[model samples]
Target: MLEESIRPDNLALVIVLQACGILAGKEVPVNEKGEKTMALEIGRALHYDLRTFMLEFDNFVCTALLNLYGKCGAMIEAENVFMSFVSLDVVSWSAMLSAYVDQNCGEKALLLYRQMLQEGLQVDAVTSVVVLQACSALAESERTLVIARNTRKTAALEIGRAVHADAYKKQFAYDLAVGNTIINMYGNCGVLSEAEHVFGVLNIRNIVTWNAMIAAYAEQGEDEQALMLFKEMHKHCITADEVTLIFALKASCSMGCLDVCHCLYFDIICAGRETSSLSASLIHAYGRCASLKDATSFLNELSEFHLGSWNACITSYAGEGDCTSSLFLLEEMKLMGIKPDGLTFISVISACSHTGIVVEGAECFMSMSCAFRIVPEGKHYGSIVDLFARAGDFSRVNSLLKSMPMPSDESVWLCLLGACHTHYNVELAKYAFDHALMVQPKHAAAYVALSNVYAYAGIQDAICGPKGTN
Candidate 1:
């Protein structure tokens, strides 16, 4: 239109800006060079033309420009447009706050929020929702910081609660998006009850609301409750999305609810929503329910495999005591270039231990750190020790114990003691028993293993022998 010498009015420019904002919100297709294509360039051109037309100072146009730039990940340009506002209204402030949020600049959004409040502007529902999201992002950052510094002073949750209170005071709590954000904020803070309370009182419920509540239950290990809510959601005729299905599948897996799993699996198939995650969840659920055949069948139905799907199927086989199948899947996964994660190795190593494949188990354990760059955790160490102990490799067990960065725990000691009982190694059983007691005085398995060791040695009278007796 501009090339034809057609003069577009402010209304036309506003519509163009709105289109740009929508395009920015959608995932822009990138070219081979990883740069966004012509849509973003058109947005920039429209922005420049708005400046040329001197309509940039108009509040609505300015807010739209800010939104468009923010959605495009052009935070600097968005901030520039926001600063150009001669008089900031609630819409402008909200747009800028949303822009900061879109760019994941949560701290900046919070700072802008403080400035907005100081200006004594009346915050509306949209503004409240944006601020709540900023609070959520800040809460996540606080969690990361707490983990890094090993401190528990998290101000983000407090800020979020205050925001929630403010939303209620402003009568914005009834807004669907606002209510959902509040639920999500509380859920993310590990306050499931508060999330549930908010969910219960929500005058209107949507799929997002149900998903949030279900996810909260699933996250807190309330699988039964999550499934119950899912049923309730169905009664209300609310459709489940992929997220809802994922949470439901997780709850089913946790509780070994095979009936629920089968129902959800059929629903997924009918809906053509068979994602890798869902398939993985089905495999895990079947495995937990002691149906390795069903799990393997489900895994085979997948046209493509992700690392998670592979891991789940491998774990299912391992759990079924099918060590051969587990190892076979591991090799297949490697051949397919799906790098095994820690969980994969844990399952694979456990399978080797079960089948007494000592050499392969040791090689897998070593490859975790050597080839995969995954430093073995305590569980991996425990699995390897169990493997060696099962093979009666007492020297390797001792060497692994010494190589451990931290002191051995009760489980590790229990594994060693069990091996001693199996081999009638009286002296090593005494050592393992003492270490286990040091770690956990009431370790029942360790005590039982020690007793069995004495019985196997025909020294039943010395069951409660001297502390250091062999």
Candidate 2:
């Protein structure tokens, strides 16, 4: 139409810009590259035409361009267009704030929000929602850092609370989206009580609200409360989504409540919501409950296999001490062209350790780094140490310990101590015990293991004998 010299009206150009924005907002799949290539091209072309037609300065057109740039991950361009506007509106502020949030630039979004308020711009529900989301994201990021450092600081909690206060002050508390986000922010900050309080006072409770509360409980190890909430959600006749089922199943798994898990599994199957994720959770739940037969049946009945389901089934068998089944599943997974990840090898190696399959365990451990290119973490090394300790191969165990890139942790030393106790090697047992103590000074189990070693050596006099008795 442009080539034919047909001058499109402002509404038609705005529609074209809106279409570009929509295209830019689509999620890109992992396996595909250049997913946004076409969207960016079209957006640029339309933007140029709007400028050429002298429509770029129009507030509506500029806002649309800002939205188009924001959605396309062109925040610099979005900000430029936003600043060029002689008049700023809530929509323009919201578009920029959302772009920052979408790109995970929570700090920038918060700063922009402050600027927006300082300018005395009127805030709308959408603006409030985006700002709250930014606060939530920032709180979550801080919480992650605190958790990583093993600190109990309430910085994230404070920030979230402040955002909650602002939401109420701005009268956005009753907005369902804003309310849900506040609940989620509290949940993410590990303040489950606050999350529950928000949930209790909400005039409207959606599935997301309930799921956030349940997930908060589940994540904090309050599985019983989570399960109870699940029940309450059912009583209210609110349908559970995939997320709700996943969290509920997690709670059931933690409690080892096979009955509850079975009921949930039945509901999922009945509703035909047995997606890969829910299937994986159900398999794990059944496995944790020692209902391996049911877990296996569920795995077999699935028309498609998920890597997670395979890992869960393998882990379940390994936990049951059924090393044969675990290994068989590993072979089957390979035959089905499913690449095994670190967890798969970990489970297989653990199964081998439980069954004293030394050769197979050693091969799997080696294959983890060789074939799979997976760098073994501490848990993998611990498993191998346990394997060698079980087989009374002290020399190989010592060799492996020396070759380990990282320091030996309490579990590795404890495994060695246990092996020493089994073989009645008093000197080695004392060495292992001392190492364990060095790693963790207050390891009561290490002290007990050392005492047992002395008892087994018929050296009862060590503790009760006269002082300085060598």
Candidate 3:
């Protein structure tokens, strides 16, 4: 197609590019600036004029626009067009909400949906799917469950069940997407047993249904069940997609099952479908299992790789305490014309902390958002705290703690407290212990660590302090 020397405004050129985006679906690389620019250019050409091009750019065309921008991470542009209308049909709302959900902005999507609902907009299955995703993002929070459950009041489950019942009232509960979401809903609520029961009753299982069950097992740390379900899925003639591999490998990684991780890593490669994401997941699994050599070997074998793949490799190396390799990979990623994301930097910073690369880690942390335009999330700040704490720079750690835009999580303070214990920094340990208590008052592990700090510092008289606090 590039050989034809076609003009940018040509209709055929626009159709071909749009067709490519459709063909690639979710697996396509949207993080690359060049790829996104090309997609946007093609979309502009296809749509041409928002005012004049009236015939082809109907609801379908608008949906295509929403998808094109959404996939390319042009969410604001997508929303601008989406919210410009006085009247929105269900498909329009679904498309926009789906754009946000697909981009992992479930909070924003949910907010917009509630606004739509208040405005008397009706939601259908696709909208429900997006909302369920919002629920999943809130799964770890007990408050999230109460809010989601109470707000909907069984509406999500009931509406989904009703859809299935409407499909076949005699059998009542039979539909692929509905069953899939129900499993997901239960899984999100941490009701794994219920999820399993529903999953077992499914007469026909699609990839999504299988993935939901596998992910639920993984979330519950049921490594054996997760692995067994993968095998069962294969026996039942359900083909494994990239999602299945990622979730199953996550279980293997968490269990530190090096053999299983290695096997799945090879399987992904042997399947000859080398998405950057799958490559990253394999690297992460190997990293979590502490198999750095295997992770390195897998990364080196990738003939075609990208920034995300390299970031995953760096993350594994960092987690394995190989800061030199992690930094080297980060440099290599930049040299390959792929910009590092916040996650890439987080792993790199973690590598520095592991190896006590204080100056490098500090500089990276300071420049993270400035240089890479990647804002540091909680995980990144946690890495920074680890870096300072490892260097026994307690004051710097405390400064970082105070500077956080959001309240620091328990793990951040725990990292500081552990480092203080390692370096016999009693005063700092106490400070971190106090913060941890405030963040997570009922944490037994933090209390134990604080007790150890007091004992190690000859503050045995202060033992009463920790005991009373507990």
Return the TM-score for candidate 1, rounded to 2 decimals.
0.65
The best candidate by TM-score is 2
Give one digit per residue, the lDDT tens place, for model 1 in 411-444: 7888778878888889888888888877766567
> Candidate 2 residues 1-470, lDDT tens each?
87899998788888999988787778462222223556767888888898889998888888888777777777677778888988788887888898788766677888888898799886777877787677666655542433542232254456557767876888888688888887777776678888888898998988988998898899889999999999999999999999999999999999999999989988898899878889989999999999999999999988887999999999999999999899899889989998899899889998998799999999999988898789888788888988888888988988998899987678888878787888887777777776777776657888788888888888874432112222
Preferred candidate (TM-score higher): 2 or 3 = 2
Q: Write the per-residue lDDT of candidate 3 for residues 1-470, one digit (tens) a residue.
A: 44685333335433554684664354445564323655666666655543353533455556666667776667777887686655678888887877777666655766777787887965655666666665554443343434564545344444334433443443434467757877887776667887888898888888999999999899888888999999898898887889999889889988889988877876787788578888888888888888888888888888887666788788778777889888888787778777888888888898898888999888888777778777788888888999988888878887887889998777887888788888899877877777777776657878788787777777775432332464
Candidate 2 residue pairs that clash: none
The worst-scoring run of ten residues by lDDT in candidate 2 lies at 461-470
TM-score of 2: 0.71
Cα deviation of 131 in candidate 3 (Å)?
Answer: 6.1
TM-score of each: 0.65, 0.71, 0.65
